[model samples]
Target: MTRSRLTPEREAELYNAVLDLLREVGYDALTMDAVAARTRSSKATLYRQWGSKPELVAMSLRHSKPVDISQIDTGSLRGDFHEMVAQSDDCQMERDTALVRGLSRAVHENDDLLQALRELFIEPEITGLDTMLQRAIARGEIAADNPALKYLSHMLVGAFVAHPLINDEPMTQDFLRDYLDAVMLPALGLPAPGV
Candidate 1:
């Protein structure tokens, strides 16, 4: 069947409907028919805009809110680490909810979706963190070539995300702060203040 063309706004509405469907039904059970019904659109329209489930899901994730790393600076390295931990904690709490778990499952099932998500959502956040580290280096809070900078993103965000998925405990600010002080700070060759 020939597919009808959609306006940009209609496309965005359909994409949001896909996200809502994913949240409600999960990736494995999500269907184009359900999405079309929810958005009051048609299966042909979804197919015309995005050829498959992976493509549609990937596009929805890509258009989701972008991360903002604009507020990160505390006079000393320890302070900066604390601020970063707080920022990461807040970001995780804000964005990495059950919906993300659904998206994660989708990506796991589809290689193309996985690649698109990494390129669109994950990489940019890492790049923004890298830029923040560069600023710290310029301010001499950290060595220009510190190895810790290489591991910062994973240490700050990855561990938190993994713990709940692996062990089922919610990540709290207290745990994050303690982790930064005991593990991350030392790994970077920096000591917490008064230590």
Candidate 2:
């Protein structure tokens, strides 16, 4: 799909409005009309730019993050992981976690949203992670055939969901930093942090 033509400031305004609506009413309840009204743009323009509500929501979520995981390169897998954890502050992580949790239920029931998320958000993230892993393999930080490479994304994503579910608190940067040091590194057959 072609990218949105809206100016950066206008696009940010629209994305923020969409996120606010998502927070207030969730994906199921959010409507194109509401987004149009909220952003003060006609529905046609929104559809023209984003194609649909699911795409709009997915795009909004992709835009909300301050960093793109794909672009982080710290010259080592460990450094890259640390950079990822350090990208978001505690409060932003909490909000983003809650937003994702809210979208999870909706994604299951809506095929469009799922596809949109995969195309606009999830797939890019997976690709970025794959690149990061490839770099690790090239640097000899982890063996190319390390079994844990296959499950790395699952482990990281699990860290996000499992923390709130198991610990009853949103996962923070500190928690993720420790998780990378203790779990992810060891699983990849690398020494623990500071070793």
Candidate 3:
């Protein structure tokens, strides 16, 4: 069965159903049967569209989001960084949590799934951050080739997402602010005023 057989509307409905299931039951517990039941589609239809569970999950995640990397001029690098940090205080966090957990489970077990997710979900965010940093450089807010910019992307997100999982605490806005001020900005070669 080819994707051409399924209308665009039908595909979107099925994908949205998968996202809903992901939010409700998480990735580990999600199953083709469950998705079929939730979407009111036959399991064979899902199999035809996506050969395996990981493939289905990967496709669902790819379709479920529009990555936002818009220019946010906050008048200063600090303000821009703060705005960027603050943007994650919504559904994006929940989606990232689910994607990270799901991808982590699959990374060691399934190479194809791991590669698909790295290409689809992870690389885009990294590239977007790089673009943001480039814009900052072009604006003279930072050096054109700041070394810390090379690492700020991972530090900003990894600290929030990975550290909490390591230490067993929920990520919060205050923690995000603290991390941005103490870790991210400094790493990006920006110090607080009069420092």
Q: Find the candidate with the highest lDDT and give its number.
A: 2
Tens digit of per-residue lDDT, candidate 1, span 1-195:
232466668767877888778878898889998998898877887787777777788777656543345355565556765676565465445344556666766777789777766766668767766766677677776787777778887787676567677768766667677777888777777776568
Q: Give the whole-model CA lDDT for all candidates, comma-separated.
A: 0.70, 0.90, 0.73
Ranking by TM-score: 2, 3, 1
TM-score of each: 0.68, 0.95, 0.75
Ten-residue region with minimum lDDT total, candidate 2: 1-10
Q: For candidate 3, what is the TM-score? A: 0.75
lDDT of 3 by residue, 73-156 (tens): 666777866777677664566566665665566578778767767776667767776777777788787897677777776686
| lDDT for model 1 | 0.70
Superposed Cα deviation of residue 138, candidate 2 (Å): 0.7
Instruction: After the best TM-score superposition of candidate 3, give how far the Cα of residue 20 lies from its true spot, in angstroms.
Output: 4.5
What residue pairs are clashing in model 1?
none
- lDDT agreement of model 3 with the native: 0.73
User: Which stretches of candidate 2 lie above 4 Å from their native place?
Assistant: 1-5
lDDT of 2 by residue, 1-195 (tens): 554577899999999999999888999999999999998999999888898999999999889878877788899999999998788899988988888888989999999999999998888888988988888888888999888888988898888889999999997999999999999999999899678
Candidate 2 C-alpha error for residue 72, in Å: 1.7
lDDT score for candidate 2 against the true structure: 0.90
